[model samples]
Target: MLLAAAVCPHPPLLVPALTGAQDGPPTGPAAEAATAAADLRATCLAAVRDLLATAGPDADVVVVGTGPTPGSAAPDAVGSLSGYGADVTLGLARVTDVPPTGLPSLPLSITIGLWLLREAGYDGPARARVVTQHATPAECADLGARLAAFPALTVLLVMGDGSARRDEKAPGALDERALPFDTAAAEALADADTAALAALDPDLAHDLLATGRAPWQILAGAVEADGRPWKSELRSSDAPYGVGYLVAVWTPA
Candidate 1:
């Protein structure tokens, strides 16, 4: 099951290249990208591993997601973390086709969600997942119900552009919200393109997921980095571009 969603393009692109169609060993840009993702993955893994290392071994940390340089998908295990073993499952796969920058993209931010899930010991795989650039209110509601199934302590981590929006609408369900945003300069670079994604603002990003009134409502409101009033709340061809957003965690009170 997907515990968190990430918006970064680096991981999705790099993972496939590192574990390419006949991989002996990952090398070149793909290898570099894989290493970078692994490093981040390790950071997230250690957060849980530290809690489990002394806590005990039933320490089930499942990082479920498509392929890349880990689990059964990779030619060989990339490298082991100090405290955890990752389980790469098939359901975590990304929609095939549309290579980003010549590299296959996997929802790499899923790793963070997996780490949080492992820390809480809610290890069941998801029956179905909604993977997209953004999810609608209906989608968030459906996901919330699916996540509520695990009676055990569970941490719902959301990664990506619309995380904050989703959680604000339903804070009682999600546990955490995270996004790996580009720094100020990086955001500035996006502005130059006039691209939808390029408008994101680094500073406006929320450090943690904000609570949502209704898990799905979070996906409804629109925002702009400049604090400019929304030109139109109603869906239209000309809404002001949104740059930067709030990611959040929702849990039952």
Candidate 2:
């Protein structure tokens, strides 16, 4: 059965070290970026904590995120943030002494999820699953149902970002549909509306560069499979650096 779930963005800047947010307070033009990064990071951490708290002690923690290919990883797998230009080791495996390159690379999305779990001090059994962005809504939902069948109760930390084209400066540049697309996604997640999620248009999402579509659909599938009325909160909904990033939580009501 599914317990609680959290949704967070997978931007590398969430690592404070990357943004120099750990150095000290920022001034001038950098302040806005720093502050938004801080807020997103804090909310992501809290959402992780919230889901963990609601999920019983023995519940299995699984991080589901989008990637170029579909796959899964065990906690023993090692991960590194060197690709993000950060020296930090994402020790989800809890093996600090192992050189990062000693193990095959964990997917970038999963690495971000592990970083959040590690920061929240989640020293328990954890797993990672990756769903390719091109997956159809039906495919994502089917995978979600399977994810919920863990022998023990389960909690999912879903990591993926919304549209990347919200403004003139966006990676995909401003698209008229970006805002509406992200807005609908935010509302569906905030409301735990499985039907709405299941109805998301994959082709449209692809156009706007919304990576969260597959992961979010998976989340909805998990809850629907559990057959429970769920409650949700939209913690953060905004586009910083022109990319849509939404933070949210879902729990069996």
Candidate 3:
């Protein structure tokens, strides 16, 4: 059964190393944005830590995120942020010296998930499952139901971002409808409203460039299958850099 869960955005800038900071101080808008990103990163780290703490030391963890395809990887799988111009590499294991096993490097979402686990000093067994953006709501629900069957205490770290078209400066540029969509999503997450989350419109989400729809729907399915009363806390919700990033934690009631 699901013990706890954390939802976080997977922006590459969450990593300090990818913020493009120089040896000295930063200036102008870059400084302001950097500070905001730092704050968001800290909140995300805290949420992840709290989520993992809800489970036993030996409990299993499942990291769910959006990717180009659906796949799973072992907890010890390796991932790198070099593609984002950062040299940081992370894995689910504590020891960084584990030799590579010729497996494909994890996608950006799982990479961020692994980074969060390591940052939070989580030593428990954990694996990553990536669901494609194109996955239907039913498909995501099916995946979540299966995850709910894990015998041991299980926690989930879900990584994905809300609308990227919140403003003119957003990655996808201004979209008048983006704010309402993201606002509703934030409310659903904050209230732990499984039904509302499960009812999210995939077509509208795709149009708004919200990548968190599928993953959030999967989480809703997991919650439904677990059949437990749950409570939630919304840690942060903002459009930093014009992308709607939200952080929240869900635990049994």
**TM-score of each candidate structure, all chains considered together:** 0.29, 0.94, 0.94
Candidate 3 residue pairs in clash (backbone atoms < 3 Å): none
lDDT tens digits, residues 1-253, model 2? Answer: 8888999999999999899888899899999999999888999999998888988678888888887668777557766788778986664454455544456457777889888987887766578888888999999999999987777888999998889999999999999999999999999998999999888899999999999999999998888888879999999998988999999999878
Which stretch of 10 consecutive residues in model 1 shows the poorest summed lDDT?
A: 232-241
Expressed as tens digits, the lDDT of each residue in 69-107 for candidate 3 is: 687876567788888888777776555456434454788
lDDT of each: 0.29, 0.86, 0.86
Given candidate 2, what's the lDDT at residue 115? 87
Backbone Cα, N, C clashes tallied per candidate: 28, 0, 0
lDDT of 3 at 26: 74
What does candidate 1's lDDT look like per residue over 139-182, in tens digits?
Answer: 43344454434444333233332323223333323323323332
Off by over 4 Å in 2: 91-101
